[model samples]
Target: MNERHEHLGRLLTDAATRLGPGPPWLVLGTVPLDRPTAGSDAVAGGDELRRWVRRHVDVWPAPIGIAAEPPELHPDRTVFTPPGRPAGTYYCELHATGSALGAVQVGTLKESPSDGGEVWAIGEGALAWLTIALLRLLTSYAAHATGWGGAGVEARIIPAAGEGPVVPMEVWNHDGGAYGRAGVRRLATAGTARRTVDLASCLSPALTATARPLVLDLLRRFGLSESRHIDPAGVLRRSHFTGHDELIRTWADTIGVPSAP
Candidate 1:
């Protein structure tokens, strides 16, 4: 493997080891925040996404909120909102093309936190869910960077154990906030080589078994297929701290992912 691929693999493996075994948790990655014009739609979409997640994943920790700030930094106390259910708050930062969209971050909540080992367990689960969200967002961003067009980009997760075939959840951008059914037309185009490499680099093997299906289903939903040339282990590595690393580290620390020596 190339240096970047090897490095990311090591990091993921180390993270998995540090996290240990726990309940099957979903790492939903970050969803992209559309520009200010779509602000209200983004809010509705966030709420819908949060609610959909609550249904599929067990043990949601509370005080979940979205922030413009990175997860390592404390969000504005005044802006934090506890979920209707009781729990400590965890925040996920949203982005679009490397710029922070503070105005769009207002008033988004995920779930409330629980206590004790349960909190750690839940945090790990939340990390998985967040990971998925981030991957999807990154995929969309990469597609745009590669010159793909179209509004209404989204990724959906249906738990493996859940009753039906897991399909991509339709995300409404400028489509009047309507959720589309699975098997819809492609929203984002097939990822470019760079996009594929970045995705492979960021995704850990430990997560592949679960995350792979979600990704494929999303591609299918978008009317695209996985690129044949993409090597999950050959992508060039940059700093792991770029993109969603701060949030990943914040959650990893909470769940006890080992720090690099």
Candidate 2:
């Protein structure tokens, strides 16, 4: 592994340990703002956001909301610990648009430690659901955002915070508004080496020895989301976050994964 890949492995492994027996999904993205939107209200997970997330992201802490201040040094976050399912807590930070804490590089090739401030650690959720949700969230933020950033969006699927198969992917915002300005900022995978297991794993004597990069590549089949982000689809449909159940179900075929019965 190169220095950069090795570095991200460490950062993600540590995050996994902190959020462990975890193989949680981490979705990272940013948008420029006219001004920071910090306040005493739901600066990040405001009611509109809550409704949007609930519809798109399964297993979201249904009442996700953020107080504009601490509990968390992070400016905006909503935390949830289900009754006895402590390991299944839903921890997310959308750092108020202008907060310094929100400034992160999203698994940049430079190898940064500036996350933890922006890591939204979901102790429980499905990868497909999270992937769909990330696209939904990024599209909304991009459509509404006042400006743009160099780094567009990144998503990582980590099998173990200790060490295991990891898959990372990124795409850029082309027009600043939405898709296909230059061309749809298509999703592409990135990692220290494309052979992720070749790098390392903390799993066991067996599993890590023979692991796959993860199902995230399936996300690329949709090109991170052409049906959802681009048109041919209508403007109302393109900008809206609904109408993605088919996408989620197409990629999600869970095994031993619990579901509401």
Candidate 3:
């Protein structure tokens, strides 16, 4: 898979984990939403898309970043700002692929702004759940498409340029083939058990070690820990980062810098 596909997979996985398991929280294949029609120059034809997004989405109403269609959803381009954001703001991607509609993506837009606007901060709580949701959704889609089930998944926090450690997450492939390698039919089927464990360990340290705790804490606070599952309604109703102190510490520690612990 190219960088676009990899990022697409990443985005979907983020949505699935963060959104959690429930009604209206469906895992979908990669598709396009803006500039319906197919071609290599999908990203170029995003004027209409920008207008549409501004009309619908409440956050980031202004166009700060460029929008292009992902290569996977050729023909339908997306209008979005690059990733990164400020404390009070968020950005998302909207697209339709095949039969899928209104695939909303938040926070993958808003990279370092050229205009020098406020950048949003992705706290630990959001990062943790977002990582899992993305993995779960991507794994499900990959499994369904490849006809091979996923064994496990993982994630981590990595430093971004001029930013503190971010949740640079990845998922393990139970299959033996390297990720996105050409001529690999079933990505989840080519691996041996030894490789599987190693891959899982490498891919999911963030998920197991940190994200799980963050999620557990959030669920506990909402009196939903016993549910042992994500509540989409609750999340959608008021979606913002919950934990602050621990998140800041995680970012600091992950980056090997000293912050109030």
Candidate 4:
């Protein structure tokens, strides 16, 4: 494996050892805010990704909220980690405002041991987990409407705190608010990679197969999808997070919970 990948693997293994057998807990990673955005593209470790998935799954029942605060530093607004712990864990929290738009928070990526600031560690996993949770929750709550015609979904990955290499994804349903909606979505997925969702699956079940093409065409106009040729009969095919139920369940095993809490 490459050095970056190898490093992430080792960190996750250590985290497993620290947590012991049974269920897994969230892991956070720190990144420098000043780091180049390009560096954020690095692939996260497999173990880290696994743990991250577990964390998000745990929050499935609760209203999924995405935040940028330090899990250890921000306890009340955060869920994954406790406060004043000084651990470099990912930040996970609910976007409780009820409004779909806000400034998604980000955590610090680089910390010096001498500085005693929280550095990246278990937090990275937490960030990743939170990313997916937000997506699922957004879809769950989205209003299913007709007559909009051709609304598409948009997703992107962004880095935070420098350590990023995290994903910043969004699902833009249609125009009149595509950018605005995307901004809110990014805020939801900030600090993790898996949060990017395939918007096609989140469509209202009431939509007929005949209308699927129109929705996709509209989505393309908003810059969310690549083509107007999307098939309504293939909505499931466009979903990026589907068919991974088993994988999600396995990941939860590492986090100590059977599934997202």
Q: Against the true structure, whose lDDT is highest?
A: 2
Cα lDDT tens digits for candidate 1, 77-111: 12212343211222222332311111101111122
Which of the predicted structures, 1 or 4, would earn the higher TM-score when compared with the native?
A: 4
C-alpha RMSD by candidate, in order: 19.5, 17.0, 18.0, 19.4
Question: What do the candidate models score in CA lDDT, each in turn?
Answer: 0.28, 0.30, 0.29, 0.29
lDDT of 2 by residue, 1-261 (tens): 254344334433433433433323343333322333232232344555554444434432122222212333333433322333222333333434421111111222211123312222211113323333343443334333323221123345433233534432333222334322111222232321122221111112221112222223433432443322322311112122233434323322321111121
- Residue 134's C-alpha lDDT in candidate 3? 37
Clashing pairs in 2: 13-161, 16-161, 163-202
Q: Can you write out model 3's per-residue Cα lDDT over 140-226, one digit (the tens) per residue?
A: 223322233222222322212233333221121112332211111211111111001111221333323322433443323323232
| Quality of model 2 by C-alpha lDDT | 0.30
Which portions of model 3 miss their true places by more than 4 Å? 1-68, 72-122, 162-261
Model 2 Cα shift for residue 51 (angstroms): 4.6
Error of 4 at 112 (Å): 31
Q: How much does candidate 2 score in TM-score?
A: 0.35
- What alpha-carbon RMSD in Å does predicted model 4 have with respect to the real structure? 19.4
Instruction: List the lowest-lDDT window of 10 residues for candidate 1.
Output: 99-108
TM-score: which candidate is best? Answer: 2
Please identify which of the two predictions, 2 or 3, would achieve the higher TM-score against the true structure: 2
Decide which is better by TM-score, 2 or 4.
2
Count of clashing residue pairs in every prediction: 29, 3, 35, 42
